[model samples]
Target chain A: MSKLYESQKLALWYFSVALVLFGAQLLFGLLAAYQYLNPDFLYGVLDFSINRMLHINAMIVWLIMGFMGGVYWFLPIETGREVVGIKLAKLAFFVLVAAVAVVVLVYLLVQTGKGDFFTLWFITEGREYIEAPRWADWGIVAVMLVFYFNVVATVIKSKKLTGILGVLIIDLLALAGLYLAGMYFTPNISVDQFWWWWVVHLWVEATWEVLVGVLMAWALMTVLGTPRKIVEAWLYLEVFLVFGTGILGLGHHYFWIGTPEYWLGIGGFFSALEPIPLVAMVVHAIYDAGSHKLRAANKPALFWIMAQAFGNFVGAGMWGFMHTLPQINLYSHGTQITPAHGHLAFFGAYVTANLVLMYIAIQRVRAPEGPALDSRAWKLAYVGFVITIFGMVGALTVAGFAQIFVERAVGGATWSAYIAGQEHPWVREPMYWRFGFGVLFLLSYLILIYDMLTIGKRAATATEVKPA
Target chain B: MIQGVEVLYLIGAGLVFIAGAGLYALLYAYGKIKGSILLQRSSYLFALAMLGGVAYIVAHPAFDTFWKSLLTVCGLTYLFIPKSMLWVMERVHLREEEERKKEKHNPFYTNY
Candidate 1:
């Protein structure tokens, strides 16, 4: 293995913290899942609302950190230079860590405050995913600014800006800029939600997909050893398709948000097309690996990325399409059906993408010890991924279907119908399945963290595999 | 008196399941994913889920024959779509192969 770059080493810090947050996120997720099965599981100790808020926030933050870590790990290699602002990058990491710690403590210790400016600024933002208070939000912006500076500066110093770098820079800016949409206050609930999707929908569907395209670009370069020209061409095509479809796909979200009815058509048509680029990329990877027999150094990373593509198609593309049509959305809007999409889409797109990146970094950090694909950690994560895709997503789909059937289709879409939806065995039974699968995923997540944190120590005694 | 909305949803949800699981079938046909027991089993679980789904539509007290028939059609759609997708992909691969042969016959046909 080659000598480790300083920039890549910086990735370890980001991944470590990201994993900690990932753990916290899933644990909270398990609690929330259980609360559905047993509403009194934690009672007031860790209420479902607080637990859910923690889960969503942790997921968003950890995924962002994972994205940062992936870029920090891959950029130096892509550019053949150290990160330009190494010292500042380190400081940003710590300060972001401190901010996250304080915010979590606030979320846990002082769950809510008076509904005033002071509360919104310092206590909680009261948003779904972007629940960090205004002060924490600003701090995040500061950290993101540092991240952007380091990233852009490194590319500038490299003097070799490829398509990937160009697209990455623009996407990074959009990713950061869109967060502000959620930070604002407005009197109109309809208007507020209109822009809110700019942050949530745009982040998940548009900017984040572009970011994945950029990261996957590098991953393919590493794994398949594909030519830069060919890779860049695909990246451009992918970017073209992603932004082309995904930008307008926000209409799917607007279908019920008191937006104009035209959104139903626009969102339905475009959002339906969002899966094509991802599935295309995954197929290309398979073809390259199968036809070329290109042995990726870290097969687990490749495997997980492949899983992510399939998961994305299922979660975001298929499930989303099922409900995006205004006709369908009318019945299923607020039901468990939404969570069915949310769970799989978030896990498939961002969570697995992070897992892929984490394994890639782990391989480099533990290079020449043994192939990481052959490790206990990879095995564990793979099991977790399976249980999640099948158990978590599949079970949720059943539950969502049940909710749609009982709560809306049969129940006249009434208030009492919503309550009746909760008691139905079809809906309630799958919550247990979801909770069980969630626990398995958490266990796998813990083992992965243990493997990552201990890989350094274990590398000392690990025997290297000789060439076959 | 069956209208269009819920029927469309039931069918759409079925297709979602079909494609979600059936996608792996396409991958399998393409030889993209092979010999991985985990993925293979994962796909099987995905397929079995369709049965579970069909059962819900079939036996749910709220649903009448209209719903059941619609859902049954979804099961039929699921059964056929994967094979059709694979067959279509096979034609694509066949055409690609034909193009390769024609290029190979030309002396000046250089990949470079």
Candidate 2:
């Protein structure tokens, strides 16, 4: 194992924290998936809503943590200087983790019926994505500010303004700014829905898209030996595509909402363009790989990078565009189709990007001697990735299509009809398939984590690591 | 309520739109074309046409169908305008790069 800079070490700690939260998130996700088949399985001990809230909140928190870690690890390298405010960065990490712990505890211990004023401060807001209480929201903002400040300070102090870092900084600022939209309360449901999506859709589709692009550019340059000039040029194009189409793409959510009617066309057209950048990304990755004789050493990291590209294109790009149109969304809204898109999109774009960063960090700190591709950890992680992707594409997609067919196409679109449709053989059968795949996905995640832990030590002990 | 004819029209329009999009994607994915700006902007026209056609066919003013039609027309128009703008931007960038390269080859050119 090679020694790492202080900031990079701090980033590894953040990665470890993210992994812990990720494991917990998947556990809740499995439970939530089970609830889809048997709502009464968890009953009083854990309501479906509560289970869902935990599952999503954990996913969001861990992904953000992973992003933060990536920024810490990469910023110094990109800027050619050490990260600023090292102590404060550490403090911010602890504060963020503490906030997540408190939020999860409240979700578990406190029920939201007739709560006292104090309990109100601690309880969830019952909103999707932004379910954390006001205090936790504020805490998240503070932590983000600290982290953001540290990143910007390091970049500015280094006087190295690379395009990749510039995009990342812009994305971080946008992420923090958009989060404020979710903090305020609104009595009107339309107004609330409007702001809710500003946070969710903009973060996932716009800012995070840019983040992924910048990170992918960095990884291509580092691992594939792609020229910085070519990567940055593509990054510029991505920035334009993401902001130009992605912001307007938020209109898709407003189609059925009480918003103005014109949003249907505006959303349909613009959001339809959203997949272009992702497709471009896949092309970019392929072009870079084909053009350069990449270092065969970091094949796992390279595999992840390629997966991130392909998966984002298929999941976020194709699958997202599949139901993004107003006509299709009219039928598929709030069905299993939504989760089908969410799982693949999140995993492909953000999750895989983070895993690539994790691999890089692991290699840098622990296995600097050589590649650990032959380690049991890498093989298991690869297997897990395959299983998870198959589960999402095969099982979840089948379930989503079945849901749309039975509930909306056949069941006449009433709430009771939809509930009854859940019991249909077509729907129920695919859901069981989803459950089996979900278990496999969970097992894969565990094996991947074990690989991360043991791969470094095993590589250190052995003189030569074989390629898997 | 959507009639049988309207449903068929909607389905046909959707199929046309999907076919156009699928073909456009294949062009980019297979490296038959490069630089997505032009191809993607062109693809939006198909989507807008489909949305407008659906709005006209359904004619069920529910969910703001009329506004949707208006927006689709506006979007289609906007796509062309941006294509031209991006073309100019690319030209300027390429020109600047050329000038920089020329200067780099001139031995007398040095920072003051």
Candidate 3:
């Protein structure tokens, strides 16, 4: 197939995988949240830590797939050239598919008592092991190289490239850093734990934040009919703020470890500023949308974009700053407050940003000339997402604060103290509400799936655009 | 015994890691709030200075706990907190034309 066809195919492949993964994430999230409420909901079958691992791993992979899809759509626009190598792109796709299957297979095998290659968690069995073999780890890394090569090759061949390519290059370099970091460490949780964050937390939060800023700016500009140059300038400023100051924020994760208290202070201080770019995102988005509100009366795509910008501001920027203080983070780092920052920042900012990319991709590929968000159903999904996100953030924040109070007042300093404190009425109260609100989030996904399928179908047939 | 050196190595490694991470955080915050390339550039330079200081202390292995701890804490706090929180939100505004319209509460509102 031609490169254009291949790009379309790859785009669909990414969206399909992402939706499936998102579905899995919603289910696992519900399960994990359920465990918190009942504590015995699936006690015998699935342990909390194991389920937690799956929840996080699934969320990460799905988001990565979404990012991959977004960049494929973006490369053409940023470079003004179709991606160069069709076969290589397809090869990367197949590898990624196999890699995911390997992960799922490994997860299931780790759950069962068949084999034990790499322990996943310590539930009661012979320790949790990698559901897939170690080669799968290296295999995924190889696939990453393939992806980096494809994008780099395309950009190198293009006569002109935008600073957007700088964003992509940074992601590539970070992945390389993560791979090297991964190999530098061992699988032992005790020692490997901190270094793993070097890849997991830092790479995802810092480098990926840069990528999201650029991609979101690109997508919003396209959908809002804003100028590319204007968007590019905003993107450049955001990227500089993120990397220029964001890399140090990684220290926040290092605090409780054997690392010095100084790290906690520094991490806390610098991360306070981490939200500058996020604040900029929200401010810019609100301004753009509000300015165009009268002109662009149609609000489906723009609504989601605006919502994403606002969500990122609160989720990534404000909430992140709240915990960046050493005094606060000292108490909240491993506790529920971390999750409060996590759910919003990850879901609200990062994932929602990617979703906007999906919306733009569909709009562009289909070339719908009519008013965006014409369908009542799509509007419902957008509102559903907003409501669900708001509910989750509110619930989690209250729960986190309750947890901190209980830990300090009732639980004391030992492991037993912490566990005993879990039984407190205050802690238990918010746990129930958090789980209750989580169900609303699950329902939102059902609406999203339905809306995504029917997006471009009824567009007056006069427009001959293909459905994404 | 090998165990003694192992413990020392671990401690030394921990100090180095924390120092590097902490310095980076300070540099980032300083650069971001100022929106000054010069400030950002100088922050990176200061981070290098912190690294060098930490390396010196590690290599020297002094027992002046009070001084070392004070330096560490001071370095860490400086590394993390931007010299000015007042301008951070405002600098965030300067990045985008759209954001400036919505928020007039810039920390530098009076000066500007």
Candidate 4:
């Protein structure tokens, strides 16, 4: 497990890119948070719309890079072959990096253009998360296709299709194919939204989750030296629960989007069940920790995976269930509750998943022929994790609940309700707390980066390596 | 009356109930695993205490029949979800074993 294939070096490149983008995402996120408290903070210099777009887009780019990096790193490990088209894969990497840089420059420098097809094609499509403009979208698709082709060829060459790689290919295909769902425009707003949710909801809820499943299974095996049968068993069970609940869980989003009345029942019912899988995953982690006598060969990597489990449970499962029921969504829709759920879910599920891979990758690449490195930064990062997950998320949740009551529950979406919700003491006060925690998160990111910058290069004495 | 934490508490009750139930499932499934008996037993104790908290949350002045019923269903479903997961795991393991046997290789480690 400590030894990495030489081809795994390509993954480090992707992770390094991801690290920069993740930092940018955080900066933009903090900017958006500040704008919430003070709209005039950036004023015309950097509009909230622009800042928020960068925040979200940067997040998507960085997290996807994490996925690609993890896949590249592990594919060789699983299949016993280096990635096919390695030179092309690296070329695709540059194309993607350049495309991201161009898109951001265009977003900031050229901000907006006419709403005609030209703007849609070149400048901005004005969609929420996938706002990379149409041309860039095509470029992204091409890059992903290269990544996909490399993975497929390697799997074929390996002549061995383990459960993890098998599911991984299917997920990669779905991942690439689903991005197309958000590319085109529709005449009807509902139809447009329907397709939009295909990209947004399905990616996070479906493909990304399956991707996490594969990665998590591999990670547990690598870190815990758990038997393949047990991990694969959990993988299959997770797939069962995720597809059973998450697909229809999109019904919650469908409820108000001009969908059928049946969605109310379906969405409410399925979304409630959504938390079941997350809880189940958390339980499985407990089982592993208990059965293994509470030790992981790679503690930092396992810590993030455990964080993914609990964080996703509290954030996506519990927080989502707190409001996703049609009855509750009635009052919490479009409130800060949405962000409250989103921040935790994204941080818990995907961000932690990436961190798990990064920690593992860093560990492998940093000290290949040596004992396990000390988890100096992880100890510090743990504090940041709590501050962000608890302090920041708690602030937003309270703000959301406050807004839900003032705006949706009592005021019922009236004009006055919007204003009252905005002015509510609960809502306004929590923003300051959110900003405070965000600063702490920044400090935490610096500590993590410090670790990233100088892990394993030191001459310090090595920690005792546990037998995996 | 209805603006603040009353609703938040209801959500907390349902989640707490689920956590307690999930802990029970973990204890039952992995209670024999080494060194966690006290941890699991204390967790079981907390699970029992959580029930009392759920009761208080439900009995709050917001206690309407619909809310109470919803809470009940949430509690019961979670109370059994871990059991259901265990059953599903057993079934999955059996299927995996069958697939591996038929293919004469571990399905997870080799193509089946």
Which lDDT value does model 1 have at A334? Answer: 80
Docking class of 4: incorrect
Interface RMSD of each: 9.9, 9.9, 14.6, 6.0
The deviation in Å at residue A211 for candidate 4 is 0.2
Query: What interface root-mean-square deviation (Å) does model 4 yield?
Result: 6.0
Compared with the true structure, what per-residue lDDT tens digits does model 1 show for residues A1-468? Answer: 447788788888888889889889888998899999889987877789999999988888888899999999888888888999999999999999999999888878886457788888888988777888899989999998999999899998989787889999999999999988888768898898898889999998899988988887777665544555556766787788789879998898898778887787677656545655554544554555554463555666777777776777777766775666455567778877788888888887788788788876666556533443346776676777677656887788787778777877777778899889888898889988888889888878777777666653344345343332
Which portions of model 2 show Cα errors greater than 4 Å?
A115-120, A293-295, A369-377, A456-458, A461-468, B1-112
- Give the distance in Å from residue A104's predicted Cα in candidate 3 to where it truly belongs: 1.3
Model with the higher DockQ, candidate 2 or 4: 4
Q: What does the lDDT read for residue A444 in candidate 3?
A: 77
TM-score of candidate 3 versus the correct structure, residues matched by position: 0.75
The model with the greater TM-score, 1 or 3, is 1
Q: lDDT tens string, model 3, A121-223?
A: 2222232222224566667677777778878888889866666687677777786667556544455554665666677666766778777777776665556
Candidate ordering by lDDT (highest first) = 4, 1, 2, 3
Question: Cα miss at B46, model 3 (Å)?
Answer: 34
Q: RMSD to native for every prediction?
A: 7.3, 6.6, 11.0, 4.8
Give the docking tier of candidate 1. Answer: incorrect
